[model samples]
Target chain A: MTDRNPMKDQVAIVGLGSTGFSREGGASSLSMALAAATEAITDAGLTAADIDGIVATNEPGASGPEAIAAGLGITEATHHTKPTPVAVFSLLDAARAVFTGAADHVLVVTPVVMGPWNSRRAAADPWRRGARSGILPVPEDATMAAAYAAWASRYIHEFGATKDPFARVAINSRTNAAANPLAAVDTPLSFGAYEAARMIREPLNIYDMDLPVDGADAFVLTSAERARSLPHTPVLIHAATSGIVGKNDEDQLDGLHRTGQHVVVDQLRRTSDIWIDDIDLFYPYEGFTIITLTWFENCGFCPPGEAERFLREHWNDDAQRIEIHGRIPVNTHGGSLSEGATRGTGHLREAVHQLRGTAGARQVDGARAALVTPGGFFFNPQGAVLRTAT
Target chain B: MNGNSEETDEETDDVLIARFAGNGITRDSADHFRGRLDRRLLMARCADCGRWQHPPRPMCPACWSWNMTMDEVSGRGTIHLLMVLHQGPPATGVDYSTGHPVVTVELEEQRALRFTSTVSDDFPAEDLAIGTAVEVEWIERDGTPMPVFRKAAS
Candidate 1:
């Protein structure tokens, strides 16, 4: 098989927009999604009709992409597709679509509404039901919780890392979120408060996980040479790369310090000669606290097993500084933990927001370069580096 | 499983029940189901593929060939990864919101099997490491056997 790296070539994000992050909102996922893309197009000084492709998250059939395109009054061209999940998936798809010459000036959108059901609301939305019910077909053992929990158990055994230190990640994320007006949880927190909050899993608590919100975020990327011509200040896609390892579905549970996310980072870093430390900002798709720790360490942000310590002293470091910023920044948009789950697309939109200097209160000053990494629990992950190529 | 012979419906909650196939898994996995009828834990070895297939399949996932059979594993592995959820055994009507930890064990056959149950009582409170030895167990959920693991026999 040939190694297909769709990240080659350069594209610029000239337009970006998103809806207010929330659950149980006034508009349908489609209408809310349309509003976001339209805003980005308008910001780019391009009429919605100029949009060539629609990259979308969290909708079924042709309804989601077509609806957004139709609402923008743009003709439905070759819109992209990924089984609706998160913002990062849409962003990655948009980049790939652009790379494939599938479309120029692509609009990436994510729409989430806390589904109207108990199980969907309480734990996670059901993907295993239809496939298992023979309503749809999928590979076996594809959606098993015990596999992940068991995998977490394996990480615990090998790394000597436990819940408490990881919980501090949640605390820090929430603390960062407090400064973000767009963040869902406006309430401030203390370490003691985090410790006092009722634990959900032994180590992962209610705070450690991201808030399940309903909304959409959108961005428009074009050729880098045309970036300045667009209405918004565009960020160039310097390099986009994706990787997977060892049937990544359960390989995270395979051995010590071995994870699919890490392999993807290593592959991208090795090929591009761009070390993780050179990254100005990180928009890691945050599903939980452990996810970030794994990325920070495995991506060469720090040596293995030092993620917690590095994060612990992040506030005190001068060498870790990126740009003139006081310290390296991760998830400046309140992240999935704080920003009400931009879904996967949120991570991409946030990266665009930072580069566009439109991230509002959470915008990191002098943020010229940024990295966006999106991952999947069932093992699909893609990462990109977005920078001010001007 | 929704009351069919082709697949088995294992209830994760009142609403969610995952499906298991006896159609394409390995003979060891097939026998594992047989052992399940007697409430025994089972896994498979894809000798050709040189890898273990959990929740096994008839064809080797690695080699993509049907030239594979089942063999009983020693049922020994390590607790390589874990996550303590703030939630519980799926939508159980319990006031205690301190959800149980979810664990994944790397089995002795060199495959990962997932389990969501209370951590073993003997486990430590802080600073846990990876690669701790594990012994598998079955948690009976409404008569269906849900596999869980504890730190190996010390």
Candidate 2:
């Protein structure tokens, strides 16, 4: 395949592993990385000795590639590097390494050891800094939430979208999480509870935010030919891309709340063989409720400014709740909203599980193709389209 | 003992310097234009293309030219979006009383150029809504004037 369809039918996700997600009391970031990487390599019917390349995405301190390689007793890791730190970017980096013949087999790993976000304890925390755009002198804690709130408010005012759809997304995620044994927040969140929850920032309650928990997710990528000999079914990486746009700060903020869907989906369609409607499973990377709504519109599921209405009509049917068999079974692993915030890696892992027909209780039936988007804030939104061998 | 104490003091100085010298929004972007806003607000206009920008930059975004000029303008804007922060305090270490309203104001200078600032606590939350006209009202905190907003008279 050429760059027009780079990695399509060529690179396959041979193995996937996660240090079963937890809210607390797991290993440290480095330990989690090692555990997940070991599991992934073993799951692929290989050992650490077979991995020649490693990509570590944004897990700081002793969790870089060298640390993980040493922890795994991998002495021959010739290719090691860190990407933009976003989880999806790490997967893309690993895939690129394999595609270019720079490495034979590549492992991508990110472990998020969650507790109280102690910015002071870790100086390298990317979120510990102020707004990069300098659009406002926003303090670190208030940077993203405040930005999200503004977008929600503007969206509500413009489209007459209420809190109903936003709250529904929160409820739907928890509902999906209830079946996922590895999900952190699986307790049923009622509609009333969501409406009455304490506002973290106005227009957004505490439930709107992603649950930060201690966990790690890992994936192994090799050539499609090599994947056939592995222990599991190969999930073909059809399209993987990162999207950016040139716009004013205000316009960028709007795009950010939408998870940069316009740029990301357009990029995906250009290179992929299928359109949005063809995918059986969709994983919209969500850190909040409104983000999911924006993804629906940005991914061509609905017209612009019409996601709330679309969800209100098509998504709220009691017989067709967003489950594995429901209309557009989104985020079958509960997503970052309910699944642990391994950044976007958890969603990626979940997509692989469904494509492999091994998602256990949360498996989407006859799931052949899947679309997974991984993004936070607005910046570099990334995504991948995966399909089982046809 | 005297020499050791002197050495300790120098090491502490170095730690402080390194801590504060870490990267963030530079003064040229945030503070350099404060003197201009002391009386009236100003936006940076590209000398090459004459495009205005907020959170002023050293060079033009439109033309990438180093030549930039500040143009005086009305500090008036409309509240495009608004939110109230109630949880943890900001990095500024200021715990606002019962939390306060933070707003994104679409400046009258350019429809796309917006500024994010706080609303004066004196204004009741009920009186505010998106599209409400507001003008800059400087609030002096720790002897530094920061721009906040209040409802503009009809």
Name the candidate that leads on lDDT: 2
Model 1: per-residue Cα lDDT at residue A226: 63
Candidate 2 off by > 4 Å: A1-3, A60-62, A115-142, A248-259, A316-320, A323-327, B1-24, B30-42, B90-97
Each candidate's interface RMSD (Å, one decimal) is 7.5, 4.2
Q: Write the per-residue lDDT of candidate 1 for residues A148-183, one digit (tens) a residue.
A: 344444455556666654665565566566666666
DockQ of each: 0.31, 0.31
Docking class of 1: acceptable
lDDT (Cα, 0-100) at B12 in candidate 2: 44
Q: Candidate 1: what is its chain A TM-score?
A: 0.83
* Over 4 Å off, model 1: A1-9, A58-62, A116-156, A162-165, A271-274, A316-325, A376-378, B1-34, B47-50, B82-86, B89-103, B111-140, B145-154
Q: lDDT of candidate 1?
A: 0.59
Model 2 chain A is weakest, by summed lDDT over 10 consecutive residues, at A127-136
TM-score of every prediction relative to native: 0.79, 0.87
Please provide, for model 2 over A102-184, each residue's C-alpha lDDT reduced to its tens digit, 9 standing for 90 to 100.
88889988887643343233224443223132223343222454667777877788888789878777777787888888788
